[model samples]
Target: MMRSGLLLFFIGLAACSPPVTKSKAKIEEFRQYLEKSRTDDGVLLESRMLAGSNGLVWENSGKYQGDILLDDSQLEDLVADFAGVSNDNNRNAFVVANTRWPNNVMIFNYASNEFNNAQQNAIRTAMSWIEHFSCVRFRWRSNERVFVRMTGNPTGCYAHVGFSTAHPNRVLNLARNNHCFSHGVIIHELLHSLGFQHMHQTYERDSFVRINWNNIISGQEFAFTRFPRNQVNLHGLPYEYTSIMHYHNQAFSRNRQPTIVPLRSFSGTMGQMEQTSYWDWLRLRRHYNCPGAWNRNSEEIMKKEVERTLPLIKLNLPAPKQGLFTDEDNAYVRALNADTNNEDIVNEEAMDYEDSDNENNNFNEDIGNDNYEN
Candidate 1:
């Protein structure tokens, strides 16, 4: 009986061991993967591809029109960031179905044959950097519609940036050599897709012009631009030197003469960094409703932002009372009343005079007739 009891206990222990060990191993593997893949403090890597099943269709309607080509590796980089996956296996599994999403991005690229290696790399880098903060996608076209002719038009008007209500595609001038290394231009154009207007009027203007957030940010525009106006509640973006979106060349000249500085010196001229700002990250995180990856102070800062924007939201909303009038309105009403009273008095006086005149005329006639009879 003792031997039989011991045998039963050993069989039960053996039955539980495999399942427990397997689950523990699986958890350990997952934990290791998380540690390696985590970026920006466990924030998932995020980005979308530019192409879709039907492929890119072109119409000769808008400015900065051209074909877009997407880089797969860059797309992978963005996915790694979105998934927060350090393990190669996990990332592959997540993105296997699709690299692009319906709402995330619209990629614009040219055919592989048309673009050289340098231009391709530049596009990839620019897209990757932008994807770090925003949930935008890419749209690559097979045929090249717009060509950048350096000799014919050195400024390359073909490479244009524009946004519209119907199809919001960011047009990149891939033909221009100037834009080849221009990450800032790429980001600036992308911001337009996200509903940001130009920071300064012309490229000739100084880059350091201060932005008044209250004056510029509107809910209507925000909705149109597809950016989270609520998330962009800060006064201004931080001055980041390393931000890829910063102006490439300083507008200031040592000779005290206005000159078009190269894109490389744009940030130095502006006295800001070439990298993305803290405000930029904040806006992206809020717009996407991303999980908490920002610093502990971020919560406090976001709370303040919410408070700061409450008044603006209220200002945009229609007032509850419909018939309420202001002091100016009251003054106008009083003036109109006074004018009406004056007109009434003048009419009354005119009527009284007419009656008196009629009575006088009859008396004059009677006196004249009696004199004649005498």
Candidate 2:
């Protein structure tokens, strides 16, 4: 009877699956949101995206291939003080400080006009889920000096990564659409606001995944970045492919080919928006130092929910450097995209003059992104 029940459950999970789209609209919309809302130039930075699906497969935000969310103002003083470590070698020297909200609380105020009743309820529901899983608490603002201004801009979705003592009036923008309303997508952006970086940007990500430079859209190579060993801290957790923080495997693809290829073999899903994966909740707990916030019973329930709701991730990754294309192939893709074929070329010449600390902090505003659904 138990075996039959499990089989039936698995079959049900596979019933509704979303196919991958070509562009990164969620990411682009985040950028558009920042641009249109007159966010600080410090928050407005370079961005890239491919077509996306209404399904919760791919999501993007500017800086480090749509991973980290906050701009310079939202970063810690350490980042602002370091300013610039100019070139690639210098870039390696800078590590944006790992930041989290003090006292494990994130205060927010939604612009009354940005969301309708349904959208507002959806946002609150996402907040409740985060509160349910970890020690992190979300509260409405009464007079907190530092708080997030949740806006309903028509452009895209974005959030300040972590607590910003430097900039108290931080923003998390989600447009009115199926894209921003999906619980998983809301959770993803909220994680960013909570200071969680993208999974692929982990310092050790190179060991777990291989990035195909040639397959990425030309001149948008900055969309994919591997953090230096000392820059990012994972709170002692291993890489998690299913974290809400993960970008889709096909993110930043240029010719409908995957830019990031995993190295392990797993017959389960990689990116799913159904809910927070086990590792995601664990990391959130670790970062906030929230001991015993999530109990074993909660874990068991969520684990089953994830397995029963998400598609099985069937990953047959190639060994590193095995059957993987190289930077040399980027030349062809650049030409195909009508982009400069030179891999050596750096897109941001202005970046060369700026300090490394400020480079990845700018953010994009959200624009209308049709590639999302419930």
Candidate 3:
């Protein structure tokens, strides 16, 4: 009787199989699951320290293409592509159309007290570098509904691809724990937050360089996948060998072999995080539709704008209590005290500079010209 019951149970299960429509849905789900597993399983949860050919260091930020953070909609689009599902409308026709900030202003804040004076200066300097060629402006966060909140957490220096109305309060983390405070890395993350994708992953990349599949870390080959034409618009820019967004030859190499080999003879390094190339600036200008941005002096305009709007921001009343200090806190306090003491010294130096000859005060003339071969 027990054997008969078991046999009937098996027969009943076979008879109750899902219908054709349900089977099709189940197959799609399975395919999506496989794609997700394939893409995410190989991602390094811990940050990997990487150096460019120019000796500039950076850390891989997130799961998507190493550092690019994708929202749910974006991830779905990517997974669809991985599963060989063609999608014409992956949210917006152009990624920039909906992602670009209004009035070309990037309202932001030092979200945490983790950023030291030097780190803050480096962040500002990187933004200043972008401002030199584009109309994009950065400002201290105010009551604006949308803005970039920059925090120095131990989360490995990742940022959202661009501004989204749905994902307002966009975060751009510069990981203090990972030493992701370099000028170039900060600029790179800033570019990501500004809606730029990796240059090497452009759709036309195969013509420019060859990918050595054997050298790429197993399962991490997804990182080398090209962005489809619908996803990225190049705005008629030529394929640049020295784009800062281009990966170094040895990037993601398992055996330290060249993963990205240039087809054409190039004098400059593929990845130099030291500075943004001219093409970088040009693309940014075209993205923002601000060709007239280069007319103004960025430094003076930013200084004047900050001075005008800073005092208007309302201060927090009934300020929060001070928290307990860790060992790191003690070091931070020391640095803060030293910085406070240097204020007067810096003021005095500025006064001295005012009285000096213009020719002798060319110290900062090359401040924004800090570019390598890239």
Write model 1 residue lDDT over 1-374, tens digit each, in one string. Answer: 01100001000011111122235454555334333322122211111012111101111101211111112332343233333443445433432322122344453555444444444444554454444333343556445342211111122212222222222333444223332234444444444334332222212223434323233212111101111122122222343333323322222222323222333333333323233344554544443333332333443443333343233222221111111112223322233224232322212211112221121222212211211110
Q: Over 4 Å off in model 2, which ranges?
A: 1-64, 67-70, 73-98, 293-374
| Candidate 1 to truth, TM | 0.33
Candidate 3, residue 182: how far the Cα is off, in Å: 1.6
Q: What is the lDDT of residue 37 in candidate 2?
A: 32
Please say which candidate is ahead in TM-score: 2 or 3.
Answer: 3
Give the per-residue Cα lDDT of candidate 1 at 9. 7
Q: Which tens-of-lDDT digit does each residue in 158-208 have in candidate 3?
A: 676666776686778766542465556777778777777677766678899
Worst 10 residues of 3 by lDDT: 4-13
lDDT of 1 at 139: 53
Query: Candidate 3 overall Cα lDDT vs. reference?
Result: 0.53
Candidate 3, superposed: residue stretches over 4 Å from native: 1-47, 50-59, 90-97, 292-374
The TM-score-based order of candidates, best leading, equals: 3, 2, 1
Error of 1 at 166 (Å): 3.0
- TM-scores for every candidate against the unseen true structure: 0.33, 0.61, 0.64
Query: Which parts of model 1 have CA positions greater than 4 angstroms off?
Result: 1-102, 139-170, 200-273, 287-374
RMSD of 2: 21.2
In terms of lDDT, the best-performing candidate is: 3
